[model samples]
Target: MEMRAPEEIEIGQDITPPILPLAFTLSDSSLHSHCSSCFHPLNPKIPKPKPNNSHNPVPIPCNSHCNSSLLYCSHHCRHADADLHVSSGECHLFLQSDTSTWPSELSQLRLALRLFLCFQKLGFLSPEFLVSGRIGGLMSNREKFDIPGRIREGGRIMCLARRMRDGRFGNVVGESATDEMVLCLVLTNAVEVQVSEGRTIGVAVYGPGFSWFNHSCSPNASYRFSLTGFIGEPGSLEPGFRVTPCGEEGTFKAWNGDEDKLTNGSCKYGPKVMIRSIKSIKKGEEVCVAYADLLHPKMLRQSELWEKYRFVCCCDRCNSSPLTYVDRILQQNAANHSTCLDLDHSLCVEEAYRELTDCLDQAITEYMSSGNPESCCEMLEKMLIESSKTEQSQPLEPSPSNFKLHPLHHLSLNSYMTLASAYRIRALDSDSDKDNQLEAFELSRAGAAYSLLLAGATHHLFSSDSSLIAPAAHFWISAGESLMGLVKSSKWSSIIKKSSGFNLSSLLTQRSGKCLLLTELELGFVLRDGFDVVCKGFLACISRISPKVWPFLVHGLPYLKDINDPLDFSWLGMTARHEAQALIGGCECEGVAYIEEETIWKGLVLFALHCLLYGGYLTSVCYGPHCYLIGHVRNLLYGGEGSSLSENVENIC
Candidate 1:
């Protein structure tokens, strides 16, 4: 859909039209949580009163084949879909095993079986519904999966097809319609059902008309998933998909509330996908939806598209170079409506890092808890203004010159984390006004992005000094805490409304966990690197903090070997201490050397300690017990140094 020049739009504007899934299946993980017929969540439509909680009604199942496992929103919807997919004998295959334990890949197989059943129900295949261009198009790994070998493993599919061929479903014989073609169609055309930003609830196959929309990395359009309200009328007794009212508790829970509920005396909700515009589209432009996450780095975005969708992204954003200091300075000045007469792009890398580091140092000094809040805010603003210019900068190739500095560089990472922490502290400041909280939230949001980007995708950071680990871990923990704060803030409702139909809260909450895991993984490496002298106290403190981090450390140590570095300490062996130790090194026993270094077990303590400390810090705001726990850990880490840990905890609370 295209628009004229005067037609301007903003984020969250519905893109004129919406599309519905042609055939959908719940993910194995979500099957137990949602009804099998209408795909509505299995949770109750209205909250049961406290008095009736113990007498809550049980849901009716689909059929004997899905008695305990499959559920429906209503008997009508259950019966409506029963003749098509479930009763046709496909549902029995899923029922034989524990449905909840099914692996994710089985979704594709399930979708294939359902499509075949739907075709049989219609008595014939419709040409309009089939995708053209090629067989198994855009489905990666077709060479391995889409084989004549399909028939070798066709016993179950053949059996199911035979059962569904009971004179009513097109009278199709066993050899009449092969399973390979149906499997190919499902594999090539299945669209992921995204329930929230960066999260998929299930996979669905759409009519060819719906699948024809092209993909874009910087898509002007976006989509959201919901349930169709009812069949035709509000109180009509017609059988259709049912939707539970969306509540205010979560972004997706409640509905618009304008529709009548008792229509048809049945609750019907079917899966619906609505496409909306994030930006205005000009006349003659194509409508697009992002097939992959836009938040991922360009290389990842392009690589996944190439591998999965068989295309390369030459999107403007991908083709463009990262913003340099000069580019940013000019943009910022232009946004401020300030003069840019002295613009210069000749800044070298060393000079750039030096300036950024100096700006960060000054900001850190002013960011102290002892400083005035106003002064600290000003300093933080300046620090962010300078450092964020580098936040998205990446080189085509890493070299020792200006291109070498990634966002994860010590100077940039520290600056971003410091600014983010300061903003969060101000946002939660007891004496601060609402305006301060708003501004703090904005800064926190941006800072958290940079922080997360640095830790996770900045692969270059993995080769840097071991000393950088502690600060990086601290930064990631701060990012997670700030995200949790946003999740709990009142501002979230408005944020959701303006979020281009994406679930901002869910995205942030998911990212918070990712940040924590990244922190744990990084600290695992740190503990392994500094096993003996440097990590002893850290390890001991952690064992008391939480014992859970130890297992992760034990499993994650081998991957943390800094394989990108030429001087990796682990595989290359640390410097020898004594002649006797070297001389008596090892007598080979079953292909193992008896030579000993510091016990790897000690590193487990250090890893667990930091994980506990960081985990506690992230939860300190609402979990008062964790507040005390983090406070103790902070005091343990810096007993006589200062009140940094306590101040951080206080700010978070």
Candidate 2:
């Protein structure tokens, strides 16, 4: 829809317009065409002569440019303009001039300034006419006319004058003069004259017509100054009445017949307007703005607005009570503390951590009471460090099953790893029962957790269909390093070896061997490029202690050929093949040297080869060739040019 223009005044039947132009002039002498007091064009018949006074009147020169339509002489003009006689109750005939009293001339001067300023601010004055009149009766004339009656009577006269000009009054009979008419009358009563800066020339006369706009602390219509003219609506200016509609029937109707006449039957109206959030209004409710500057905090804002506006606001922020304030303060403090910590000052870091711990405790209590798991989770992370430390030191025997681990201990792999390192460090420092037990417990737990992570991680690396094999392989390598640390730690070795024995043969028969073997396989795949060096070192150490467990080495060969997973498979396969060759080569040479030339050495060799192939004799044989040597015999068996027996016999010394 197109927006309407400003400067549009609605002239209803009861609406009244100002009859006199909002302009006037001042003079030094009893001017001819000028008013006796203001020195504008005065009505010739109604001469405002000076009152009799004991003091001699001072004579002042009149402006030469003024018209010479003489009523009063230059001497009278001078006496009337002088400050001495104008006060002293002697200027009654001169339109109530009392210069000695500040109210008399001072009020008029203020009124004139206001009118000039208004013209500067707003573009035009209302077109409706008003009658010239006086404000409150003079103290001397109070007994002559009833004060209230004069005010009421004067209001009625102005209303009639306005209605006559408008031609008709609308509906709603028996009402008082509208606010517009009342304003015009009030202006006439408070009219005054003013002089320019040097007092050499007169500027204009003005009145208090707009003063009836009232003083609302939370007023809706705001005034703004304009140099050109008033621009109404959003953009351009136009001619029409700027009426704000009322929702109720006859709610704005005039109270009296005189008022109705003044406004030409239009409803009583004032500058005080309402701005509502909705289009419709509710009964008995007064429209309002917040009355406070938007920048202030809620508490301060409400207090100031309530004191000045005399109404309590019910906004959501205002009604939130003290809890909101507390929460806001805490949040602000937290933000500030965090910023301080970011500077990396040690003191600030400690302080921030302490404050965060306190906040977490409070938040946890609140969240638990409210039964909000999400909020609880948020707080749990904040207190994770302290919680982990406390739980780790607590005795394990008496702990409840559900609460056996701290939240971090249960959830984060990092926490488990850290705990394991701490225990290992402490065990190295002290050999006490407490340290030993704690170390063993933590290491065992860490090992278990690492094992689970490694399984998931390695599966992703070695799975035939795995898409993220490269990245998974990288993760598996790192995980293997962590497990290797656990495997080689003095505390772990002491705990395991002391509890059991240094029997690789026996261990290979148990679940522990499978776990170790799987760990080795995964590590080999992860560190394929370094597998020969790492696996050779490991095997060499195991070989010196337990030579009987060589078959397990042979069993790992198939995994080398068939495993195409992206992890370091090549290095692992090559290392396995190299170890098999070494073991089989040792068996062939030794058996040929020790056995009699024909005493079934071939069967024994073949049996050793079979044992190497199947891993069945790994824990049984005490003195045998390296298990890897069997792979060479098998290769020879397959690659021999002639019969296997013929080639074997030729090779025998």
**Which predicted model would earn the best lDDT?**
1
Query: How many Å off is the CA of 224 in candidate 1?
Result: 0.8
Would you estimate the TM-scores of all the predictions? 0.43, 0.18
Candidate 1 lDDT over 71-105, as tens digits, reads 65566656766655554455655544433333336
- Which candidate number would show the highest TM-score if scored against the true structure? 1
What TM-score does structure 1 among the candidates reach?
0.43
Model 1, residue 429: C-alpha shift (Å)? 25
**Candidate 1, superposed: residue stretches over 4 Å from native:** 1-12, 43-57, 66-68, 95-104, 121-178, 196-199, 231-269, 312-405, 408-653
In candidate 2, position 498 carries an lDDT of: 43
**Residue 276 CA error for candidate 1 (Å)?**
0.9
